[model samples]
Target: MAKKPTKDPNYKVIAENRRARFDYAIEDDVECGIVLQGSEVKSLRQGGSNIAESYATVDDGELWLVNGYIAPYEQAKTWGHEERRRRKLLVNRKELAKLWNATQRQGMTLVPLVMYFNHKGLVKLKIGIAKGKKTQDKRATEAKRDWQRQKARLLRDRG
Candidate 1:
């Protein structure tokens, strides 16, 4: 068998919105490029960014990331970027149309799932096409998770 490729050392997760999976059901996800200033990139490298409160939107034929937070870079005193400013997301025309249709016609949401550096050291965002979960749905999910944990524990003990 051919040797499996190893994980890329350059790939690193900067921020992840763990709550998104709990609050919404993710049907699909797409990787997107984000436009960032120098200061913002420096801040992300230092690793205090937050994507929990951020979301993606398709507007005027372009995708944008809104409410994303990148901590200010102290060294870049004069040219520091805004911490919560909207950032533009890059995607192809066909993907943009699909995202728009999902949001406008299917009533889905574009939730930011993770921000990470790819193998080539370029930053990327994974945005999910999700639908909001009802309270009962959340409860059922929690119950299922609890059962899974209990079952694992039982298996471990018996083995």
Candidate 2:
């Protein structure tokens, strides 16, 4: 038996968008901080948020996360935040310029890949610059993934 690779202890993942890979060809990944309301942060701490259908867009030179769902905290009844509100993303000027240029000039998109808390306990979003995949491309990706799984199983059994 072999020990699995040690996971990083500094980051605690809150949610992931597994479907993003199936729908788009990811090009580059960028980590950016999120501007969250106190109630929203509390809700995320309790965990059941979804970023699967969410996307990031640059508006007026600012990046905003759209369509992401962070469930309302039951305890904060009066201060609960909107479940699907557009949250602002914090990126530096250079990265922002790069992302904006890629999306506008190259027809790329910003998709949130993972939301996690860093060692400092600050919430962050890992977004990817992606291009949409066609149906044929998706099918081929699925076929390749299936083959990899089968190959792994065969190797394990033989060993």
RMSD of each: 0.8, 2.9
Candidate 2's residue-wise lDDT over 1-159, tens digit each?
999977767668999999999999999999999999999888888886999989999999999999999998999898778899999999999999999998999999999999998888899999999999999999999999999999999999999
All candidates: TM-score: 0.98, 0.92
The true-structure Cα RMSD of candidate 1 reads 0.8
Stretches of model 1 off by over 4 angstroms after superposition: none
Top model number, lDDT: 1
lDDT digits (tens) for residues 81-132 of candidate 1: 8999989999999999999999999999999999999999999999999999
Clashing pairs in 1: none
Q: Choose the strongest candidate by TM-score.
A: 1
Q: Mind sharing the TM-score for model 1?
A: 0.98
Error of model 2, residue 92, in angstroms: 0.1
lDDT of each: 0.96, 0.94
How many steric overlaps does candidate 2 have?
0
